[model samples]
Target: MRFSAGFSRAAAIAGLVGFGVLIWAAVISPARDWATSNKVALQTSRVEAARLDASIQRLEQEKAALGIETEFSDIWQARQIGEATAKVQAELGEIARAEGISLRSIAPLQSPDIPFAQAVAFRVEAEATLDRVVALTSAVEFHSPVLIIDRASLRRLTRPGRISPQPTLLMQLEIMAPVFIGEGEP
Candidate 1:
């Protein structure tokens, strides 16, 4: 249809006003509520971000010290008190045999697996020269696998009647190492 310029101008103005009212009703009014919702959401996100940042900082600090603390915690599960004791004795025997030292006995001591620290001890009796005793201690110190010796003592024993009495050496020792839970374990 064809219209006059004056009427078309009035119709266009009316249409514009109607469009503005619709825009204000649908968008502007709801935008206020949305601004409130967004404020709450933003606050929640900031709290979560702060928490995550704190956690990351803590983990990074631990990682810097030990390289990887949580990953190595599994060592506790792999450690066995009895197994470690046997390994110590067996290794001592091997070293003693190689050094021509005779192993007489081992008085195994108490082992208690506490959460932060654990300990195992053995009182070993052997007969060897002073040099051999030192060598055994060095070997155990350097060559032991997943084991540690907290203390060791060597004593020289005297023979009563022998013309040339070779010295009998004895050792008292303590060992400590990490203990952990196995995979998929509590």
Candidate 2:
């Protein structure tokens, strides 16, 4: 009987160990796999969210720039070729006056043979100190009304009569600008 009791106790311990292993295989193993896959998916989602946020920011910046371009287009559309040229001339005159430079002439280049709707060219002559000339030219190039400098030349002016307050240089400029033709004309 004593030997039988010892054998039964051993059997009970073995059965308990086997049942624990079966429970781990059936439930714990699958739970662990699911937890690991869920963690991986969460990480991927976080990375995707960051990328989308960056794209949104870039699009917002582009939209703001487009707004500025649209405003400039509206201003351009409101004026005709002659009005645009006159506006540019006025702006240049203001720049010259501000820089204390003498604007000699602002005249349209004769393009009788070519269609007037295509382009309008201007020949501008000015005399100013070197620094003032540089400032005026920079302003013309950067300011609106979109003037393209086709040709630019500069020469030192020599005056033999008397002592001038400041040395001056002569600048000759030829600039071309696209003319806006009304829909009715062409």
In order, candidate lDDTs are: 0.66, 0.74
Candidate 1 per-residue C-alpha lDDT over 90-152 given as tens digits, one digit per residue, 9 for 90 to 100: 665686688666777766667756555455556666767677777767766665344556677
Which candidate gets the maximum TM-score versus the true structure?
2
Error of 2 at 167 (Å): 4.2
lDDT for position 44 in model 2: 100
Runs in model 1 lying further than 4 Å from the true structure: 1-63, 67-81, 112-119, 160-168, 177-186
Task: Summarize candidate 2's per-residue lDDT along 90-114 as a digit string, tens digits.
Answer: 7667877887887899888853233
Q: lDDT at 30 for candidate 2?
A: 93
How displaced is residue 64 in candidate 1, in Å? 2.1
Q: How high is the lDDT of residue 125 in model 1?
A: 69
Off by over 4 Å in 2: 1-75, 111-118, 161-167, 182-186
